[model samples]
Target: MILTVDVGNTRIKAAVFEGNTVLENFVFEKNELEKKIEKILEKFPNCSDLVVASVGNIDKQSFLTFENELKIHFLTNEDVYPFVNKYATPKTLGIDRMVLASGATLQFPKQNRLVIDVGTCITYDFIDENDNYLGGAISPGLRLRYEALHNYTAKLPLLAFEAPELYIGNSTTQAIHSGVVNGFVYEIDGFIDEYRANFSNFIIILTGGDAVFLAKRLKNTIFANSNFLLESLNQTFQYKIDND
Candidate 1:
């Protein structure tokens, strides 16, 4: 069995996979990292291979302790991957992005793929039909836009994400919602259009916290999977296992 861990900025996601099948998945607050790991280990003692794709700065010492206790090979970004690493600064590349790209490669082995991750920050990554990893764009996310409005300006109240009634909002709160949500919808559509024109039959995959919310509003068709990163971690482990 493969134990996959995706440590994000606000939360930690863990999954237990038997081969390609995900048996169970869990999400916990970042503060409860140890407890979550302990629970998983206690519940699923058969988790033999551990793979982690972390975006946040988690404690290395804690991870080391867990690896020693579990007696499993903990795969990190420093490990080898199946796809070509073309990022100019490979060391600085976010593990979440790498895992997403890895997942995309595994899902569409010989197809041009675009992966959009909408979480704390929106990220775009591309992998060609030949399985080469070409980097993509990153922009502020929905909540970031809301927080920017509240933090950068006076009198602008902090807002949470909600679908707006119309494109043109009549009031302040509605206007904020319109700007963030609609703007994102338009931006994503525009990117899809541009990319589709250049690459034929491109597969787009949407994953992250805000994926469901944005997927409903997207004009383009996308394969929406929240467990993409976790699957990627499993794939990464499989690659290592196969090659080793």
Candidate 2:
């Protein structure tokens, strides 16, 4: 079995896979990562391989402790993927993005694919039809947009991300929600339109904590795979095993 962990700014997600099949998956608050890892270890005693793709600050010592407990190889960026990594600063690239791109390549071989991860920040990644990982963009996420407004300015109140009824908001709270949520919808739709015009038969995959919320507003059809990163990590393991 393969254990995949994705530590994001707000949360840590872990999954156990038996070969290519995901057996169980769960998320933990960033502060509770070690506790969750211990629970997962206790639940799955036979996990043989581990892979971590973190996008936030993580305690390397805790990860090392877990690795020692399991007695399995923990995969990281030092390991190569099945496809060529064209990122100029590969070491600086977020491991989650790399793992997600690797998963996208495996799922859509010889096809153009766009991966949008909507979490603390929105990350857009593109993998071309030739199996090349063409990097994309990153922008503040829905919640971050709201938080920034509240944090940066004195008057703007902290608002939760909610669906706005109209583009023109009637109240301050509604205005903030509209600006963040509807703006993201338009941003995503416009991006898709432009990308579709350039690439033939392009595929869009949406994942991350707020994926469901954003997916509800997206005008374009997209494949919503919540466990995409985990799947990607699993694919990375398979690629390593096959290549070796």
Candidate 3:
């Protein structure tokens, strides 16, 4: 069994994968890394290999505490990936994006892939059928958008994410809902359409906290998996084990 961890900006999500099947899932706050990892190890004592991708501010050395318990592979920019990372600045590319693209390449092979991750920040990563990791875009997330509007400009009240009843806002709160929520839906759909316009055999994969809510409204076809990064990490880890 292999333990895969994706340490994002706000939270850490871990999963134990027995080949392609996820045996268990764990979530923890940034500071509770040690305890969450210990719990994963305790519950699944058979796990021998552990892989972690850290894009957050947490120090990678912290995971070294488990070195004696299992073989730990900490993913970084230097790691060899299955695909050619053609990003202009490869060293600065986020490991999460790289692994997510790798997961798309491995899981949905021989296809043009666009991975839209709607997490703390909305990120778009693309890998062509040739397995070249082309860079994508990034923008503020749902909460960030709401918070920004409220914080920067007075009178725009901070509103939580909720689907607007209509495209037109009936009131202040509803307007924020439309602008923040509906606007993102349009932005996502627009991106998908633009990508499809240029590529053939294109696949759009949506994953993140708000993917499910947006997936229901997107006009195009997409493979939505909330735990996409974790799944991708497992595949990336296997590739590393085979090649390294």
Candidate 4:
């Protein structure tokens, strides 16, 4: 078994994969990294490989502590990817995005793919049918929008994400919710629409913390799986091993 980890800006998401199938999934804060992994290992003693793709502030050396128990593989910009990265600045591409792109290429071959990851930041990555990653866009996520309002304004309260009760908010709190949630939904739909205008045989894969919350709200059709990054990390690793 292989344990695939995706270290995002806010949290670490991991999954144990028996080949292409995920046996279990886990989410934990950076501070709980060691404890969480130990518990996972205790449960799945067969897990002998730890594959990680980090886009967080945590030091890479932190994962090395497990070297004795399992082989550690860190996916980096220098590693092999399935797609032809056409980004102008290939070296600057985030490892998380690269993994997502590789997964899209490997899982959905001979098609155009648009991957939208909505977590700490909303990222859009597009790969063409020919397996060329052309890149996408990024915007502030729901939490960021809410925090921005509270931080910039003195009266607006910092609120947790809640579905807006109505499109036209009746109160201050409701208004904030509607503006943030509805506006965010529209922004994503709008991007999907723009992509639809020019692409055919295209597929949109949406993943991240807010994927489920926004999935129902999105007007466009999408394959929404919050655990996609972890799954993709596993696929990417296998691909690297096979092709290396």
Q: Largest lDDT belongs to which candidate?
A: 4
Taken over the whole model, the C-alpha lDDT of each candidate is 0.84, 0.84, 0.90, 0.94
TM-score, cand. 1 vs. native: 0.94
What are the per-model C-alpha RMSD values against the true structure?
Answer: 1.5, 1.6, 1.2, 0.8
lDDT of 3 at 193: 94
Instruction: Give the residue spans of candidate 3 off by over 4 A.
Output: none
**Candidate numbers, best lDDT first, in rank order:** 4, 3, 1, 2
Q: What is the lDDT of residue 115 in candidate 1?
A: 96
For model 1, give the 10-residue run with minimal summed lDDT: 68-77
Per-prediction backbone clash count: 0, 0, 0, 0
lDDT of 3 by residue, 94-143 (tens): 99999998999999989999999999899999999999999999998898
How do the residues 159-211 of candidate 2 rate in per-residue lDDT, one tens digit apiece?
A: 77678887899998888888888888888888888899999978999998878
Could you give me the TM-score of model 2 versus the true structure? 0.94
Please give each candidate's TM-score: 0.94, 0.94, 0.96, 0.98
Model 1 regions more than 4 Å off: 72-77
Candidate 2 C-alpha RMSD relative to the actual structure? 1.6
TM-score rank order = 4, 3, 1, 2
Using TM-score as the measure, name the better of candidate 1 and candidate 2: 1
Among residues 3 or more apart in sequence or in different chains, the pairs in candidate 3 whose N, CA or C atoms overlap within 3 Å are none
